[model samples]
Target: MRKIMTNKTSKYILLLICSMSLLSCEKFLDKQPNDMLNLDQVFSIRLETERYLANVYSYIPDPLVCNGVNYTPLSDEADWVFNWPHQQINTGNWSPVNTPYDIWSKYYKGIRAASTFINRVSECKECDELNPGITVQYREEARVLRAFYYFLLIRQYGPVTILPDVPLAIDAPLSEMQLPRNSYDECVDFIVSELDKAQQVLPDKQSNTREYGRTSAGMARALKARVLLYAASPLWNGNTDYADFKNKDGKQLVNQVYDQNKWRKAAEAAKSVIDKMPEGLYKKNGTDGKFDPFLSYQYVFLDRWNTEVIWARPMTGDAVRWERCSAPRQINGYIGLGPSQQLVDEYEMENGMSPFTAASTTANPVINPASGYTETGFSTTATKFTKAGIHNMYVGREPRFYATVGFNGMDWVYKGADGKTIIRVELFSTGKDGYNGSNDHSTTGYTTVKYVHPESDVRNGRHVLKSWIFFRLAEFYLNYAEALNEYDPQNPDIYKYINLIRERGGIPSLPEGLNQDQIRERIRHERRIELALEEHRFWDVKRWKIAEQTDAAPIYGMNVTTGTSFSDQNFYKRKITESRTFQKKHFLWPVPQYEIERNTELVQNPEW
Candidate 1:
């Protein structure tokens, strides 16, 4: 299956190249009706039809790369050291006209391509003859892909223009192309209905590795669950902020009324996926039959197509670049990606007690004495996870903390000049990976180890190649717990699923008899830790309508500029690294100014 997809991908690339060459030649040659003729030729051939379907699959965003679809750096979870377009977002330097990380045009282009494929795939009689039901599956794939693109568009831009299933022709009138934005609920309903139609025809899972990244019934259901979950969130549900936001015809782009049943719908949607898949959370057990939480949590991203993964891109984009940017300077890496102190503080102690009782911005963090967490002093003794003399701030934390964070003195498993050796990361000013007035250093005084394989040796140019998972089983568990807690806090299923993740992270389960608010906070915290750096934090905060408190707040890290050595206590002191901005308008990114200019009928988001 992998070989077949690879061949198809190559053919698609060749097709694109030929298309581009023909486009250039069209400038010199007489204009004819060749566009339709070429498209007709493409759909009439079996292999060419398959290649076109592969091209539609190519638009699935690359989550591994920070500059593209991944929104990690735009949130409080992590920071990218170099100046990328996403970095400007935190500073409130972007606007509708000057939008950074603008995926509006890119996704709409994909939608048009998918729509065209869906409408024309049946024309390929040769495709059905080659593989009896292949064309039917191909049409379903294209349908779901179109729905997925709409999902992405709404996720980023809130309300968007929902194009018809049949794409507009090249000769379509300009006035006909200018369409108004659909109401938020209408858009959601359309996407959900389309997904349902595709889900009925698509198989539960891809039969072969060749179709690994392609859409399946599971992907459609999982995507539906996410879309419904977002629709149920506070930002979209009863969000009065968008009350005045309407189109030229006074059609409400955002629903003004709140609905509690949306949460139930979200829960049911998530449960549907849970009840269907036999796959569980990916775990690594020791030979003694004991679950190794550290390895289990670490390897979930490193291992390709693990039991936890539901959907992943077959071709990983710039994954090695992600590792190179994450690796320390001592090992010939850029060392730019840094985790925030707020995320570090969110991790529970070995006993499952949160370290900070208050928010991260409190002058003196009210530490949890029962959790045995201390910000000052160094550990005199080594535990199973850390070395002796490591800062108390990093010692005796959860297994996930060890797996995700690269604190000062943490052992980084790497292949050295001779062979594999353990290199302790030095993140002080004078240390190897420390902030040395270069842009390639970690601004937060710490680096990230998540999604970075242990054997990845940047210095030797050897890196691991793995799919960037878009949807996973663990996310559904978190989603289920969150939605259930909102409308059915008393339901025991909430604790059951949340505890499943906690147990996998080597932490104790939640104590019984917690209130609705308490359970909600715990569930949100679980998502923060469990799905860290997986591109959920950014949207999670937005949908929950808490970005003003989290994203706009001052983000902190260790004093990277003042540290003299690895053991310098001044280096360990917490300090603000970046101050961000999040206005009410930030809940949904503004429709690109160019888009608004092109279509006067389109309405910009509120306060853009």
Candidate 2:
């Protein structure tokens, strides 16, 4: 007897047929087959362009949470930090067999999608009734997206073969596709030109609602500044980190240096964005804005068109549904992607100075319960740390520090516990489960609160709705300050921008007469702390060519044994703690052996 159909089964069968067709088509041709979409179908209206653009935002790779086997290694906490089980990385120890990061394919796929959209839209003249300007804007957006993909390539694998347009034939074989890598300079130029065109056609951030969340003139400019800054950094600029640089076309290129002009341009471009970008920061205005910045920051990853998010993938609906596969289980969220101690220590003390060396006169000292001493073994004169004896998890510290971390002694409320308005859990501890010891998540014994949803919030399934700040005002200001500081050093504008970021984060200003090196180091420290866990450290370490130093050896937190006593028990005292360390070779990731084996032109990264 034949069985009647059910809705779910029918849909599954349809999907299975499509998959089979795709597989069969692949076997029939040596080359991959293209989707059945046609130029007419794709560019029939602005809606099509909008939909295609949406694909770009939804393209973040998502892999299930199993044994911490995740996608996009940079985004993985283990890969980003030498914390927990991840400390095993970077030890001259990791061989090709245990290769950690292999991001070439995912990025290439992103590039391909952008290229397809650009090529398709440019060739179609289907905008007769549609605003001619709208078509141009769509094309510009596609170009910017394509440029973004290229920029990712240059940053990740150095030089990569850029296919700016789709192949004419759907079944074009790889043998026929002997495209060479483009020069870093040429690639940068191409991207900059595309961005220039985008700036001309793409609407300003405020005026574009229909094109909301789409790349804007400000975003294009901001990206251009970022690209220029990298080009001007030591890694790309005549530095040994890139001793054997090659372009996409396989041509050798000479090393360049941190050109003053490049820095000036970076500063100018960023300044342009800063001057025009809106000014909005969550202050201590009680209820309304109490958690708004947290919301704004989280929106970078959640909200599609958050004004604060200059550029981000709008991973929503199916994209997010698929993403759920990677989230920690409901029973207990996996601690796979935890933050590192390096990042935790990077946070400034309440006064905006390093806790390690802040001036003891002006800075507040939070006790290191383990040490039982106020100033010993801690940098009271540094930025962002309290004295040794105070509670590490005290409230009303620097706003950003509070915004960024959820420490052990602090009250951490999990959703729906005890039916309390807020279920309070201890973030800092003198025990294993306490905020800072061996079982602690962040290497520094600090857990990140940047992406976490507070217990009181009912929406978002108790999961965070904080948008990842792919690029934001704070970062832009910092970038501008870095470039200007490097270029002019004596400019008060550098101090101005740097101080603005500090003030917003609830930290003190830079002391008067600080040297360029001191200023630069502080700026770097700020970037590391402020941008922690946002997938910026990997690239920042590489570009600065300081991997030999920063990634050269395992980083560890200071060992401490805090005294703990059981209730009604005076018989014994116990100690609780946690620690991690990593090695250097883990700096440059292994070039995927599969790609190297297939393409003799490609060479594996050293010691990978």
After superposing candidate 1 on the true structure, give the runs of residues whose Cα lies further than 4 Å from its correct spot: 1-37, 287-289, 315-317, 359-363, 416-418
Highest-TM-score candidate: 1
In model 2, where do residues sit more than 4 Å from their true spots?
Answer: 1-53, 60-99, 122-133, 164-176, 206-211, 245-250, 254-258, 278-284, 287-307, 315-337, 358-396, 414-420, 426-444, 455-464, 555-587, 603-608
Question: TM-score of every model?
Answer: 0.93, 0.73
Q: How far out, in Å, is residue 593 in model 2?
A: 2.9
- Candidate 1, residues 1-608, lDDT tens digits: the string is 11123343433323322211222223322322234558889898776776676567667777776545569888898877888887678888889889987889988988998888888889989866655566777788888888898998999889899997788888999999999999889989998998889888887776554346667888999999999999999989988988898889888888889999999999999999888876578999876898899999988988877778888874343557778888888888888889998899888999998887755443458887878988889999989888888999999899999889888888888876677878888888878788774668888888989888887778887876666788999899999999998888889999999999999999999999899998898889999999998889999999998988888887788888887766789998888888888888888888889988888889888888
- In terms of lDDT, the best-performing candidate is 1
Q: Residue 294 of model 1: what lDDT?
A: 92
lDDT at residue 554 of model 2 (Cα atoms): 40
